[model samples]
Target: MQRSFILLCGLLLALPLRAADPDGKFAVDGVGARSCAEFTSVLDKPEGRTAFANWSQGFLTAYNVFTDDTFDITPWQPQELVLAKMAVFCRANPDVVYINGLSALIRSLIPDRVIRDSPLIAVRHSGKSVFLYRSMLARLRGDLNAAGYDAGAPDAPFADGLIRALRAYQEDQGLVVSGLPDGQTLNALYP
Candidate 1:
């Protein structure tokens, strides 16, 4: 299969005018996703266009993953509209990493521990990690106390996250390149 970025790039060129970001707060970074109108504008045919409409339902189903601040859309419907479009995109391109990245963005916004504890985060259904309710909080910053990750312990102060997430957070924060989520870094990330 083709790389998701190449598809995103082609999608940008293939799409119409408007802010491409789902947030519309920024330009299309090519790293995440563009807005719904932009994506829909490019649908020249009836089949794919119709498909776009059918899949929007998942956006609402999965909306819980995002943080609350995502509500800041100047015209809120656009983000929702794009998220709805993204649901269609997911059906067509389930393997797309950027889609997963966007999903990550959605969850990245929520803050409450109880909400984060919900199964929508990452339900490990089959393996050892099963029954696991991972949180964006651990992956976010400052909340890396891992309270949601390993319960019953006093937030052991253990550093959290997979290697990749830690690396991304480190690079984004201009922190020392330890590639680990320390309390200082976590606080900075969530802060």
Candidate 2:
């Protein structure tokens, strides 16, 4: 009887500890769900692309609602268009990091401001630890390209094209030409 009792107690204790964190909700960095590694693992498969599409739909909806300042402003872009752009972006940079690409999309669409209600995934830092979202990085690239900043083919990473483009955009906007996407720069670019 004592052995059975001890076994039962042990089992009870172990049960709570066995709980899973597959989506990484308890992650310290808030970037636990669907990691870059996971996204790339299945990137080439049909099911993987489908899963990403589904996730993107949910992500976009959440993002739009999060960034909505008023009921008057429409979402920055349509889901289909954004998805298509992602496909193109993915194809162009086959070796690109998906999380970064996703971040870029978010930045491009919601350049006006970030939502405070929820935390964003895939946060990185510049030299000074300036927090950057992958989507924001992508948005900066696209925006610089659109404004004729000449970032090489509009790829990810803060490369030569992005640097030159940012400088040009800043100069044209007369906003100190810092070549960095600080709050003021984001406001000008998105607005």
Candidate 3:
């Protein structure tokens, strides 16, 4: 009985774990299928520019979904920068997986600069100036989330989640744990 149990356990451990959706949720479209050579072939032409712009838009959309709309890096606006980066990566890594090259290019766009001053606190439920309050709060939440702090899900209208995320971020960054969107927290979040 003991030998049979051990064998069964070993077999179960060796078996591959299967997920309900093995392919993942996101589906890559036509442009995503092109090889690095094919993708870089038209970089200097007008058609290439048009195609790259469309492809980059898809990346931006993916970024939004991946970060839950909290990542504010704008790779789509400055098209030239992304195009140049992708071209360079593809050229240097011609034989590399296309997705790996693209991943490097996308990962390079994450912001590195830090905010200088501590901005005013943006309370979610508080009756501060309506527009400025909400916009500031949004930035606070977004930046915190980008810095790897879990600010709850997007579209949540409450303040406690933001406060908890902010507190955790502050602790991680060695800042005062006020749990409010003060300047030091903002600087750390942006940094």
Give the TM-score of each candidate: 0.21, 0.36, 0.42
Give one digit per residue, the lDDT tens place, for model 1 in 1-191: 56998998999876565533677554323423444444445466556555443343344333533333333211112344444445565546655644353555444434522342323233221231212223333334333224232222232222334434555556667886454434335445543
C-alpha RMSD of candidate 1: 17.2
| Model 2 Cα lDDT, one tens digit per residue, 95-146 | 6555557767666554344333222233222453244555556656776777
Q: What C-alpha lDDT values do all the predictions have? A: 0.42, 0.57, 0.60
Least accurate stretch of 10 residues (summed lDDT) in model 2?
70-79
For model 3 the local lDDT of residue 89 reads 79
Model 2 vs. true fold: TM: 0.36
Candidate 2, clashing residue pairs? 103-134, 103-135, 104-134, 104-135, 104-138, 151-161
> Candidate 2: what lDDT?
0.57
Of 1 and 2, the candidate ranking higher by lDDT: 2
Preferred candidate (TM-score higher): 2 or 3:
3
Q: For residues 38-65, what per-residue lDDT tens digits would candidate 3 score against the true structure?
A: 6788777888667866777676666654
Q: Pick the candidate with the highest lDDT.
A: 3
> What does the lDDT come to for candidate 3?
0.60
